[model samples]
Target: MTSPLLTRHGAVAGLGPDAGVPWHYGDPTAEQRALEQGRAVADQSHLGVVTVTGPDRLTWLDSLCTQQVAGLAPGESAELMILSPQGRIEHVAGLVDDGATAWLLTESAPALATFLDRMRFMLRVEVHDATEDWAAIGEAVSRPAADGEPVTWVDPWPGVTAGGTSYAADPTALATTVRPWRLVLVPRASLGAEIEARLESGWTLAGTWATEALRIAAHRPRAAFDVDDHSLPHELDWLRTAVHLHKGCYRGQETVAKVHNVGRPPRRLTMLHLDGSGHSLPEPGATVLGRDDAEVGRVTSVARHHELGPIALAILKRSVDPSTELTVPTDGGPVAAAQELIVNADGFSADRPPKPGPTMKGLLMGKGCAADGGDLPG
Candidate 1:
């Protein structure tokens, strides 16, 4: 469904495989600037919205996803991931619960709806593909709408919530404070008017490029761009907010525990600060090379930020040194890149052994040995 605002802004239409939406209006650089400054609105109508209704909605969803959603309050925002039985990410969604319904915002509404349908064998919940009836409008804001109000999902990125863990060693380095974002759901029919109102109130209309650039800079992963069939929450640092380590058993919970406790994820996600002097950017799927010129990983997302120049998120082998200089395959041979760690090279140390405590005999021993060469008294 092409946005009605497309006609007003002369937007060049780009039909996504899942939905038709604007790629950009005319100037993406200015759009990106506006977004970073919190003076822009994005037509995110292309995203899928699914509604789950029934008295058992929250509990039913909580039992299946990675996040703790059974106690989700009305108008509270949270994100969840549906993993395969083997612990690979299969789907993800941003969730918001109204008093009566739970709204799910995802990249592919149809696929999520179908999957949920299959899981609802004798459940009391009813899932509906609300994409046609509802649309998402994005804004760079500090918070979501007030509680018990309009449907909205405030992004919980770069923050370590309760029952979650952070892979980033330095919490102060998080960009959430600098680049906050929120998504508001409105009736599809009123989307054009809503855009007009925001425009009339001095807000610029941004495109997907602007939003994606900010997303990459903030190290936030998107399901469509960042995830693959083999992706796990720990690999992308998604356990920071999306997964509850102590949550009740859900699909893939066993693997989540095992990888986090006894093993490390095979791959780790890292941010690459690219050398932009070449006037070119490496596309997604570009080969990432280690210091020895061996393939270590592949670029999953890349963007040219308004302030940060060219940057990308890549998934590299766990053994790849964070201090090592890397190269990305580009049309001009290769581009030099430096890694800013997202996931630590050692991965989560959940299963590390406790430090040995001093025994009672050792505590009682003095620093000086006995003068007669006798053993220290216990």
Candidate 2:
């Protein structure tokens, strides 16, 4: 009933963050509190922020990433993804420009570095693992950035202060009252001091779970659970923003054009309302089933939302049917499942992250591990 990798203030991290909170790797309480009261902060020092500089930076990055980066006017940020030759996502990052350099922020894990190396083939670009140099934080507000800038993080379930107000004369003044700003901090050693400073400065720090659920609910895709080499960029609904259809060719360009113009992927990411009955709610990787225990999908995350009871982010194949009443096999028995999706007023499906990896079976399936009381590797 606890997340093995999550932490609350890093206190019970390796020790577990207690039972009430759901750990997707961070303190679920932080997230829960954030959703309930509109605020919380997370320990994002574990993510790497790669800075790309030089005159050739824009052209080099434009040729490598799926997002358009040639005209970034410093002080602008965009979520981006780098795809593999096969059209799978190699690395997905928040691409922010400070008017001088480009910053690619991703999980501190080596996967993104591996991606950067593969992407630096013939380009005159430099990629540095600034993980030890910066940290990131997100805040949701009831209004738009007071200075007139686009909110970097979009509220998935509504209630965002959305509007273009890039009117701030300075960065500090801009961030102070911004509607939704994912502030990135630098230097791993500076994370604690930075967070403390935010708290002292009266910034609302929501719990990690609340943040995760809000992003999931908002249909906003993010790292860890979202990017993998097998899934295409379009699958996560990053078409115009992350994946520019008119952009120059990148590693996955050929297949991307082919798929977008020709095929529809078999599965789609969805949100679900869970009954949370038998046993504790299933964590990520549990399989969802239709009638007769038919395989339909797998959950990416599950959190007890302050308002929505138990909710989940899942990937279900199209044949599974969005409205079908289903059950998901879990540690205990089966928990009831119902499919849901987020659609904006513009009729565009909001961003939703699919499972990072493809897995047809449970983590310990047929390994005799679970039966032997073995812990599963996520």
Which prediction has the highest lDDT against the true structure? 1
> Per-residue CA lDDT of candidate 1, range 330-361, in tens?
98778999998888777654323333246643
Question: Each candidate's root-mean-square deviation in Å?
Answer: 8.9, 11.9
Error of 2 at 24 (Å): 11
lDDT of 2 by residue, 79-148 (tens): 5667767677767676766555777766533667666666677667677776655555555543323334
C-alpha lDDT (0 to 100) for residue 316 of candidate 1: 90
* Leading candidate by TM-score: 1
C-alpha lDDT of residue 105 in model 1:
94
- Report lDDT (Cα) of residue 343, candidate 2: 20
Worst 10 residues of 2 by lDDT: 160-169
Predicted structure 2, TM vs. truth: 0.72
Error of 1 at 350 (Å): 8.1
Alpha carbon deviation, residue 332, candidate 1 (Å):
3.3
Task: Report the lDDT of model 1 for residue 315.
Answer: 92
